[model samples]
Target: MDAAMFSIGNSSSASDNETVVIASNEDLYSYAERVVAAVICSIICIFGSIGNSLVIIAVLLSRKLHTPPNVFVVSLATADLLTSLFLIWDVVALLSSDGWPLPNAKWLCTMTSFVIFVCIGTSLSNLAAISLNRYILITKPYRTYQRIYSPVNIGLMVIFTWICPNLLSLLLSLTKIVGFGYNRKYFICCHFGQQPEDELLFILSDVLLIFIVLVVVVLSYIFVLKHVRQHFKGKRRREVQGIVMQASTSGNDTERQDRQRSTTAENSISQPDPSGQPIRRRENYKDLQVTKNLLLVVVVFFVCFLPYSFLIIFPRSDSFHLYAILLALMNSCVNPVIYARRHPHFKIVLSAMIKCQYQNIPEPTGIAKRFFSRGINPIL
Candidate 1:
């Protein structure tokens, strides 16, 4: 979403009579602005690249982490990594040139714009996919959804995430449906044109797509929350029923009644027999932890990308736009940090990878228990 600034040369006959302009305080301020932008972009590029690379490596190295949902995570990391790499070129260009250095290099602009569009699109799409994956896992924890999210299907989803964006962008670029050029205002190479219709179409399409993604992500999380609440409510009801049954069947067989109550409590928490036609499967703690982590990721994604998405629709001042872009890009690096902080298994694996020491790491206390005790269970 970065725009490259380009200078539009005048072709007017009056240009010959016009006097040259000198650098003023405004010029100094503009220069300082570009310098600051270059520094920030450079830092984001370096850190984002390293952090996403670690996520990819960590997932690949850990055998236990190889799940259907993690496949989407790997896809997400790959997209972010590509974005960080592309931003490196943008950073270099910003530092070296005042305006578009290669005004005539339409092909270069188109190619770069295509790559950036694809990467950003893929990243957003993968995030949506992750949210949907969690929603299905949390709300429909049965053999049916399990089969649906099989390795083959997950692999296809990963492929779709990468290909769909590139194909759509390439189609637009190759057909000249969207113009690519240096936006002098934004000081970055991106989709731009003199045609009002084309510009409107580009802006509308980008905004609409972003809105759709936000909608899907928000709805998925909402459904997950509802499902978790229902699950816990049902579990509580069963526990109460078991207690009543024990109380009624009293005194002489008190020991047996207590044993039955404990059994019922345990069964209430355990997954139902897959062979039996139950409405819901047992709530797996491991799966719940994974869902919780993914939920945090979705929240982070929303928080980080919201401003940038807003700016795209309602671009205000240059400073706001710059900070928005930086915040959005910072999300690329933040995933690894989120993984390290919120996911114990990810932390252990990451630690082992960094230390090159394959020692046993103890699992932390149940995240579900902590969440339930706090009167908030996002996952059962």
Candidate 2:
């Protein structure tokens, strides 16, 4: 974001009092802050728009990227894409010289608030689903994995990710209840902190629920990593030291894992499946890479969403409002980078598409291996 400063365009008369001048100076500083925020949002919007679109296009163009996990990636990219597209309204609200909100845009702003809320929720939901998928892949038997992640089931999960969030957001918005309003102070949508309900509702419905979901995500990944660890116990480490940090519920537990992992790192490279074990270790490693990438996404999600959720639960200085909004916007922008740099196959497909070399694109890799593998398995 350019550090370019901004000043209100209105000019003052020479006869204005000293108090009026001082007030104008303060107003100028506040407006300047908003301008900085708007600039940062503009940058995020540009990257998110282009990057997320590329993800979708890459998946569509090269079906090789299609898998149960990429299904979530594409779903997430779609949510982030909506976020990038709709977030412009907030930017406009910040930069506009007119009053906080033009009355004419009320319904539009409400809809914008609704969309942003849904996208945030959808993104979290998809991350949780991804974590559960990883949990099953690592811990459960192949037959169990196939039964749970069948095409019909994957379709159901994706549908739940989108439809559930939309329904919840719509229900909240229509009721004119908490977490949805036209923010007057910032002249933006996504009006949180307006309707504070009771404590249980606050915990179950808002920040506490978000906190629980995050903990669940972290714990699920920890379990998957731990299961994979049993497979690699006692292997000689000939590679450079790569970190696979682990978190635990207790401080002592965390320190123990850190000490244990200090000397070893899980290799994400493809390797053969264990002898007599049917689950493909090569694809399992790919799944691990995808999980690692998404775990980072979840961490980012925690950082971005927590403050805003806290603000909703416990309101403080209004100054942090715009900053919180901007932080939330960053989540939409970071995923594409994480996927391109971290995922195994995404970068290859994405690079070819970006270079405009269509012929170089790999052949379409169909759905998740078991979702549509050879020699038909019963759907049930």
- How many clashing pairs per prediction, in order? 8, 1
Model 1 collision count? 8
Error of 2 at 61 (Å): 1.5
lDDT, candidate 2, equals 0.67
| Index of the highest-lDDT prediction | 2
- Write down the lDDT that model 1 would get: 0.66
Itemize residue pairs with steric clashes in candidate 1.
Answer: 3-188, 3-189, 4-187, 4-188, 4-189, 5-187, 5-188, 271-282
TM-score for predicted model 1 compared with the true structure: 0.80
In candidate 2, what residue range of length 10 has the lowest lDDT sum?
1-10
- Which tens-of-lDDT digit does each residue in 1-380 have in candidate 2? 00010111112313233335335434543777879888888888899998998888778756777678778889999999999988788788777655445677666677788788788888888988888887877767668888998999999999999898788766654553445545534656663432333333433455655776787798898887776665454233322223323333235666676655544333323322232223345445566777777788888888988887766444443456567778988989888888788877887877766665555667744432333345332221
lDDT by residue (tens digit), candidate 1, 171-221 = 766655565554445455555433334545656656676788888988998
